[model samples]
Target: MAGAGGSSWVPWYEHASPVLYLEQLLGNVLKEVDMPLEERDAKLKFADRLQSLTQKAILKEYPNTHTNVALRGFGSFASGFALKGSDMDMVLMINGPDKEKLNFKDIANALKQSFKADGLGVYIISNTRVPIIKICEKPPAWFWEEQEKLETQAAVEASAFKAGDGKNVVGDGANNSETSHSMTNAGVSGEHSSESEAEDEEEKEARLRRKRVTEMANKTNAPKNSKVWYRERKLGKSDFPKSDAGILCDINMDNPMGLENTHLLRCYAACDVRVHPMATFVKAWASRRKINSSRDGTLSSYGYVLMVIHFLVHIIQPPVLPNLQHPQDWPGLQDLLHDEQSQFFADAINGHWIHYVRNVDALNYYGSKNISPNTMPVGRLLTEFFSYYGDPISGGHSWQGHVISLRTRHGGVLDKGEMGWNRATSEMVNGIEVRQRYLLAIEDPFETNHNVGRTVTNEGAGVMRREFKRAVSILRGMIGRGTPREDLMEEWVDKVVVDEGGQGEGNVGRGPVATDGPLSITASLARIGM
Candidate 1:
């Protein structure tokens, strides 16, 4: 509602409408498709099969030592996916992964090949799933080899019971009770020794698999700071910087926040949206949320994911809008019920936990007083927004005025709700800061990245609501927390000083920036709130 649903200057169609479309799309698609009871069971079985392929690919991809690191250090493996049309939705992710290093596509390809060998089509679809958002929209045999890099490599190595899919975790132990003891021979001790060696090899393989999973767990640990962030969400760290895990929101509960929320909105934004794991080439896009940066970049292939979800819908039922012109009409506009994109939407609705919940209020939607949609291209709506962003911290405890810390033009702290004029840096707080960057800039369409920022230093809310991503904000908080200047990186504080042509801390440069905007500080785009 405030600033065109968080942007007064911008059109509501882009920012607010997408949210509605996403929710509607999900609903309609589910109603139409998602399959019969038998089909649902079959797809679940397929999902199980796909999971195996991906795990094997990971084992083949890395050497024992490297695989050990991936599994033990980061807990790397192919997690899972719903399996959309002509594509495979998979994630080759490491828990606590450093988004900067890992390329999501590579991981998907590895698993894709593993599946291909098993006779499954290997298409990488984007945005079918949350987080590991990438998918293979069907790979050619020629490319299968390239994609099979992991699987091929995995072929050479023996497999173990443990695996790492980044999101989930399992110990080194696997269920191989059937072959518990080595077969011993009464006549030949040497043969028995060989048998013992074979058993030892099996044990080693099992350990390797567990190692793979454990390493992945460590890698995808949501950045070490996530723990601290989780705490800050519920308990302000003024007196205690770090503490034991409290009632922190997991942001992991197939969370309505972040990717799940963003993806749903995206479906509405596009015309045949899909929900494949590779939705919108999730690797890079989803990476935006973590690494304390992951802001929706200039281009977030919103179409891929949107279409995939749409495709799934059709597989189950008729399209939401029979003659659908836009995805927003999905599930509601009836016309879309027969649309082409229905294939994707149908499955998502039936398979996923998507439906219309009338209970959410404005406070729960839009996170803080309507800010810009979480992602670009596909803006978010208030109703669906709450599903992802719940009730945020409200009242006097939060800092109401905008603190324009980046550019000295307004001293990086703009109060008085200037967002009415410039929708970028400023926003009206409904309850709490449910997202990362407040506003990139206040210019029309936010064309260039010359906006201001709102500091979440004292904002009250959940752990994920307070993702610690931006270096400026992080540094600002650190400085507030008395982080030593000598130990601090100059790239942190020195970057915040910007004037008329200065950059803002609130909106890290995702879109093109105006020459007149604030200068970017030493750090790159960042996000703190989960």
Candidate 2:
């Protein structure tokens, strides 16, 4: 991993720090909690396939509409912080002259019918602010077989080309064509040993190499027996299909802001290497603690991401990241301002100015150029993050009257009263009484009027705060202790008990907290005079 200025990252233990053990423990915990490479690859491939299929379905179903339709992915998957089995969020963008006349409900119904006709299970939800088409289905047996076959063929061709015998191979086309069709027709069959014994030693080695590559590709592309491959492993409820489907996709039509926000986050993630891992760790912690679901009246994953960004860019001393939305802070803005077509300038979208610095690479080493660059390791950053949010006595963030705002120049902190969101208000929405609370206000960077934490209910806010405090107490207790990394990891990430008897459904119970010895988490907190 590279640090802020693209230098090799120094490990936490290399620093002359007192919390070396804690840093090592947290580093190991991040590794354990992160998604595996294989799983991430499979999920991304599934998403690509689904996007292709959906695009084809739209074109086929609306042949006479003359509309240019495109599907774009957004949210965590696009922002590079997606956990294992995270749902793929996409927008079905329709262009052309008649696009303004199109009805979302009608379009969703048409797409649902088209997907069902193609033997896929789909649901259309039209009552929400933005209509959604939920698609879930296992790829047919032929689909998996074809995928494996194509991957195997490509691997063999790659191996053959690398072995330096491209001329001798007849009509293989592996030397000339990179297309999948050319590779498939390269005269390589499923059987690997069909070559004659009279072949030279070099050819034999190439054949053996091809066979090994093919086997590995087949293993990776083969479909697994498990159904609902995208469901979370630990907590929360997933409405995704429980059958042998390998992916779940949510398609919407009216959320271009989501795509913009995803790009904004991607740029922020590109600023520093520590940003992604820290955000992922915090998100996993929130999910495990049962406070990550917006539908269940808590903060969404996007809100947590904003919180992490706020901490890194504004709250932390000698910020680990620059506010990409702040044009004055970015030196590259001068060039972009002269370019009329540059997206770096704000666009008037839905009565809001949606803008951010899109060319992240141009502002090279902006983080490290600060008067006092933050050279803290990911472990130290994470520790400070927990302290800032959880331990109020440590002179950290106080969520009572303040709001989290990433767009602000003043430390990402805003007064709730100044924003006119000081108290809870109830309004009628679609004939139902809807309540909006400012308990945990988080202003969206672009859509400044939208509070990302409006879904957090009073009880949900309490639960989240409690979890935050618990994390702070436990981490404090475990710091400097010679506890095994595995034990510390389990205590932090895996040791959670669901409070079924609590007022809310997925409330977390306070179990044994972090301690190297026999003392409980509560006892450790008492020992530290918390």
TM-score of every candidate: 0.23, 0.67
lDDT string for model 2 (1-530, tens) is 78988888753333334245556655765677676788777767766766677667666656667677777777787778887766677777788886776777777777776676766655544334445676766544444354355546656766886798673332342321212322111111111101110011212233343344334333432212210100112211123444467676777675667777888888888777778888988887787666676544567788899899999989887788867777667453455545555346478767778777776554434433432267887777877787788876667777777888898885789989988988887665443344556778888787786667776654467667776776665666554564433332333332212222233322333222223211123322111111
- Candidate 1 per-residue lDDT, tens place, 221-287, comes to 2222111111111111111112231111100102221233233333332322232222322322222
Pick by TM-score: which candidate is best?
Answer: 2
Model 2 ranges off by over 4 Å: 1-22, 33-41, 139-238, 241-244, 330-343, 360-372, 429-433, 479-530
- In terms of lDDT, the best-performing candidate is 2
Model 2 scores a TM of 0.67
